[model samples]
Target chain A: MVRMTSFIAGLSLLAVLLATGTPVQAQQYPPVGGRQFPLNQMSPPGTAAQWAINAGRVAPNYLQPVRVTLPQDGKVTFYESLERPVELAAPAQAALLVGRMYRLKVTGMEDFPGVEFFPSIELIDRLHPPQGREEDFPIDFEFTTEEFEWAANGRLITKVIYLEQPDRVPTELLERTPRITTIEPSRNVLAEADDLGRPMAIVRLGGRTPDPHRPEPSFFGPGGPIRLPAKVTQASAQQRPDAVNSR
Target chain B: MKYYFLALGTVVVVCVGCAMDGNQHLNKGEYHAPPAAMMGRPGPMVDGPGPGVLPMMGGMGGPGMGAPMGPGGMPFGAPPQRPAAPSTTQIRFVGPDGMQIGWLIPNGYAENQLVAPARYNFFQGGTYRLKINNIPGRDSLTLYPTLQVYPGHPNTEAYLTHNSVPLQLTEEDIEQVESNNFVTKVIYLPDARYQELAIANVETLVSTRLDPGVDPIQEADKRGTIMAVLRMGNMDLEMPGQTGKPMAGTEQGGIDQVAYSVDGAQNQFMPPLPIGPAGQGTPGIPGAMMVAGSGMPGAPISGVNMAAWGMPITGTPIGLNGPPHLPLGGPATLQSHTVRNRSKNEIPAGVKDMLIDVKHDPGYRLPPPVSYIQYTEKHPVYSPGELSMPAWAQGQQGQGQYCPPQQQQ
Candidate 1:
């Protein structure tokens, strides 16, 4: 009787083993796509959604606040439209649209006399500061003297600005000046920045200037709308700028 | 007891069946041979003439002698070590001021010119013999060196395009060369992790500076990507002949020829001919060509055969020189050639009958795509008297708009 009971127990154990293995075998058949990007291990750029926005599939952020800080006193001009050119002093504050590329002209640099630089800013993503305090936490676009010298020497300077992820970085007081890390040309700067934090914008400075005689309309791009802070607008009004700022 | 044993055996068999079912989808096909070119070993044509044919040849030693014959009784060695495509790499010659740099052409050496901190564009994946003369201190001494520009690799492409390879002959290198010692210098771009400084710069590895038996080429390769290699020796390549002239292009003298020129008008650069019996043409030999296959009918065998009367065999030759000693056997004579494919079939039979039923589990869930976002906040109402608006803000809304209405959505 005992032997017969053991046989029954063995058959029951086999049944349990067979039942447990079926689900695992079934799950192995199909493979799921990974959530993270394989090359950079970062989320895809927001610019990728431009096509969807154009097709009326998604909404875009308009007038994202961006602050341009030059090394020395300089004039920053933004072509709001072919007919409208808004000029402001250095440390200029403007709200640009996300997923859009804008061309800005810098002149009257105290250090670099008589030299003009046409730099481009591509906002891939936006910041989410507390409501009504967007002006305080504007995306910083700092230009150094070294970068200007490199641009003047015909070398293209590409800088990627990213917001620091508090958890990933060491806990310390943030430096007053923006941290600049120059890497090899062959390295993917976007990927490197993404590894450290969330990438927000890409700034490219080159020695190319616009031809006055036969100006290329594409050089100015599709003049996007820009918004100046109340203080900046008041200061510009005091100076009596060339282009009138409209609401 | 027998009943209990029977039940246990049945359970064991069922458990084995369940385990096998887990691995049933795995592919268990026969391994197939890869392509001949992918094997990485040299092919038959690369072995050149067998060992005894050219005993005195420098690089043609070892494997050329007694290496096992491949199919069709042909000797095979390692695969051709040539780069994929021809690319021009700018090489900057730095240091040793007043040094004259010249390179060997097809027939003789090109004119030497003073080069210090000068740059020249040279085609990569080639080994050129250079004539170094008029050294600053050692004015009477001359050196014949070989510069081998390695094929550009993906790792070094960016560095080569933006920066030139700096080739500086140091004082130690000159001293070693003057003492009748051979020196090899390898220029390489060190990898990021191997670099000690923040800036990326090219590093050089000299054979004389390294420990004995340590190859500079291998060391450089381990550190980074090699751009070019310069090997120098004290051999005099332009010795005088019995006729009181330079031995180049003379019978029973030097074998150098002017195969290429810096100025294209003199002689267009051609890829060096392959070494061995399978090569199309021999270098330094006036009009000598090597044919590997039997000649086709009606085609001349090295310009020796002619079409017969009423039976013309008209077709392109199989090899460059056609058949060796050819004559018309007959117009209708049968010629046979066989081509065998050595590749194997990796796929197993009855694979079409296998069923693949892959589907996502119903329990798995993914977050829905973002469709809408709304921001609602209260703004302070400003009285016209309290807040002064600028002219631009009054004319517009104080906001510059460039995008279309649809994009604003």
Candidate 2:
């Protein structure tokens, strides 16, 4: 029994010594080639790929969430509402191929059925006769339905992303951009069409009474200067330098 | 002679008038202040007080301490000395539930790696307060768990530092450690340390490297040293193969969706996107655009310089989703615009994926071809406990965790 106690006591002492003697940091190794590894989680399952797929599956025809970069000075009209499509310029535009596809990306609007992009006619590539048909060619926006839905409503799309494809575009005209064909909207929306020349239509429409709160109270009110008296010019210095002429 | 005498009398009269005018200046009085040395000090206290005198309370008959009585004989208590304002150095610590508070001197062989001061340890565990003078009230410090592995499969455990007891790995702590891996203790710091870490760039001096041969504990004792670093990590245990496919709503899954950064450390992403030649200049090879300006890609923000880490090959930051060019899974991968340019050698041998130089044209002048270096990690390349210090400390520095020399001495 005494021997057993002694043995246990020795073991306990050893454990304590090991714990207290070697500092917590002493055990820290250089971490090179150790089991110690940074455990980064994989891309979440319902993230980009899944969300894109879900959005694509529900809509009849939708713009893939491919992020499209407009060429330098490139501008595209994003149809925020079916009533009117507002045009927004690209981050920057410089190299614009006359007939290449410039992709645009949008997000969070699975409810938005489709959009109309109206690029300037000059931005569109028109192949001369002999090279191709004279008819304006519509730009092809590729939608990936592979295991990963690469393109979703909000994905960034790029111009010249599809230059290598031989089927939709001719190899000789890879540098050229596709012409934009205007798609008319459903007739019920627009009674008198504006100069855009396309038939007026509305895909989605709804309105709500605004909240009781005033539109975010802005500090930027139109104002003449408050005419605050900055300094009490000791009544002695009230006269201006021109006062000498008056005297 | 009579004219000169009359002139002198007239001058005297004029001088007298001038003196009287000076004396009649507005608000003038005969009030005279005593000399500077005798100015504000009160007269010595009288032991026996009479009328208008304060009665002696004990022997505290000092000039500043004595209070004179009013006509009503009301004696004012030494203008109730305002309680000394709480010291900014006083730090408060609120411990986890059911935590037993103990004092931690933070003294050990690993002292260099720790940021807490080594002079004293406090036992009150619920919350210990330290006065952080410069730190804002909102300054928060996140404590990440350090992991330890045992012999058994799936035997990895995580433990967080507390003032309770010097954390010792034993059978008793196993369960607590396992449960604590998910518990990322976010403690608010007195603003002093918070501002220090917040404004410090990635390469700010957090820890220093200890010499290989020297003993850390001995060195610490020789110099009373203290060091603080922003310890950061995800709250989920994501051991590669063990963490299957991160499904949404799962702890790991949620973390995966969001980009990771050192909890409080500011991350800066500046990728010097190659400037393209304007409108149909000679179509050069897509990837070989001339590097414009002496701009290096993805430099660290704040004052911490990262010049030591060779300038990384630059890629444009696409939105806020982090540097898109890196092929997933690196220290800088998910951080906004931060990526470590890996040398050709670091590309693991037999890296399965093809290196594709895909040009990212986000509707702007075309960006240089973004080379995506793809590889897969069935397991993490570095330990979860190990943090990737700033790029400046990248190479074979002080064993991953850099501990600066003990400055306490």
* Model 1: per-residue Cα lDDT over A78-170, one tens digit each: 765456667778888888756555678899998899988877776767887755668778999999998888766545566789998888766
> Please, what's the RMSD in Å of model 1?
19.5
- Highest lDDT among the candidates is held by which one? 1
What lDDT score belongs to each candidate, Candidate 1 first?
Answer: 0.59, 0.24
Residue B334 of candidate 1: its Cα lDDT?
Answer: 35
TM-score for all predictions? 0.41, 0.15
Candidate 1 local lDDT, B8-85, one digit each (tens): 676776777667654355542312222112122122223323322311111212221134445432334531111111
TM-score of chain A for the candidates in order shown: 0.74, 0.18
B320: Cα error in model 2, Å? 46
State model 2's lDDT.
0.24
* Tens digits of per-residue lDDT for model 2, A77-194: 3321122222333331122122111222232222323422221111112222322212222223322222012121111111112222335455676566543332212110111111
